[model samples]
Target: MRIPESFFVIYQPKYTVPCVFDLNERGTFPNHPSVTGTWGFRVLADTDLKASVQFAHLVHRPGKDPQTGKAYEWMVEETSIDLDDQLTLDSAAVEKKITDSEIRSALMDAFNEWHDNFVPMKKKKVDIEELKQKLGNVVDECKERIRKELVRKNQHWVSSNIPRRIHDFKYGLYNHVKERLYQEYQSNGGEDSEPNLLKKIALFNRVLDNFDHEDLMKPDGTVWRNEDEIWQCWIGFAGSEDEAYRICRTMDAVFKDLELDEVG
Candidate 1:
């Protein structure tokens, strides 16, 4: 006969654990002799980290008791696995996989829809006539300045014996416009984001005036990583106090149900 204590037995429990592991934190895990070389240390194979954790669980598993007929049951926690099965993955590779993958992009799209529903972007009306007038004035000013600069340069170069340069470095142009453009950017609000029409024009002009012709060809794309972000999970069974409690409860219920079946 099943003991009455079976009724108090627990079966399963839910827990929230941080699934994200920063590659920088890889040093926290002990060095395994099986893995060799400096290259291995660069990226954290979440698999290895997880294996160690499971190894700990294995080490702590209960031994058989002389008095007891059955060994203590281990309640394994439910877990999810990471997307990649690679033996080793660096941060750059991981980011590329996540950011470049069509599937992951879909995830972002779905998330974007959810986020939009949660908080929609506000639409604001603009005074078209006023905006046009301001733009016209800005264009007129820019053109006038450029013409004067060009005329002065031509006169200066003609009088000098030095050869005319192929490249026109717009240092003076940028220097003159940067302060006004920055002010416009500030007045447009949103600080780093949401530049107004004038601000956008001014910024583009400033970059054009200041940056070398070759500068635009330089790469600007960069990946932003969040350490707390769960890159992936290694799904497995692990035991917790709550899981033990739940397992006890389920054991009790199962005993009662099965016992009733036998009695009938």
Candidate 2:
């Protein structure tokens, strides 16, 4: 058979293992001298960095083991076979077919030799339960630190920019009023103060009737002068853990609804 071009697993255990072989783009297995020069076949395994024996490439086959009466898959050493025509031969013409038992024994022998040499130095498998508890503690600590830092940063930003924002807002409001006053002054013959004033009042009243004041109202029922004020108010309101959780839940629900729509 022609050797596969992709990385193939020779053996795999029930748990995670480090991959040993790193394949370069030139199609050479640098880790194994036996298969270093051979091209076409690529093998990769996950093994401990300290140990030479790494196991990776999980292959799931159907059916239970006849001997153990439990479903199991073959885990063996990965080897690259040469793609040269000299290595390719018809088994029928050769008059000897390797049985499954023989193949298993050969692979097991190779695995055992490699394991014996390097397994003594390999670190013990990590206790997942203990690690999970430690992870939870770390996450809680991280959340608290992040919350505090965000609050400090936001307060600093608001303090530094509040004066500038207030000044800009005042200037904008003054300009709007000034433009209306100028328009009324010109339309009312420039010299008639009473007519200009009356016209300005009527124009402002019409503006109040047509404009949506609620557009400037924040969620907390306070009016905002500018977009920065609105953003600052929103950040302050939603900075709590509960608000974050609610937002996440809402986003998750929206995504799920979109997925269901796609499926339908």
Number of the top candidate by lDDT? 2
lDDT of each: 0.27, 0.35
What's the TM for model 1? 0.15
The TM-score that candidate 2 achieves is 0.19
Candidate 1 at 138: error in angstroms?
0.7
Q: Across residues 89-185, which tens digit of lDDT does each residue of candidate 1 receive?
A: 2334434434335434443444334323322232443444553454344444433443344334333322232121111212433333444444443
TM-score on alpha carbons, each prediction: 0.15, 0.19
Query: Across residues 62-138, which tens digit of lDDT does each residue of candidate 2 receive?
Result: 44545556644432234332211111223332123223454435444554453343222315744445534543444
Instruction: Give the range of the ten consecutive residues with the poorest summed lDDT in model 2.
Output: 46-55
**Candidate 2, residue 230: CA error in Å?**
15
Task: Indicate the residue-level lDDT of 199 in model 1.
Answer: 30
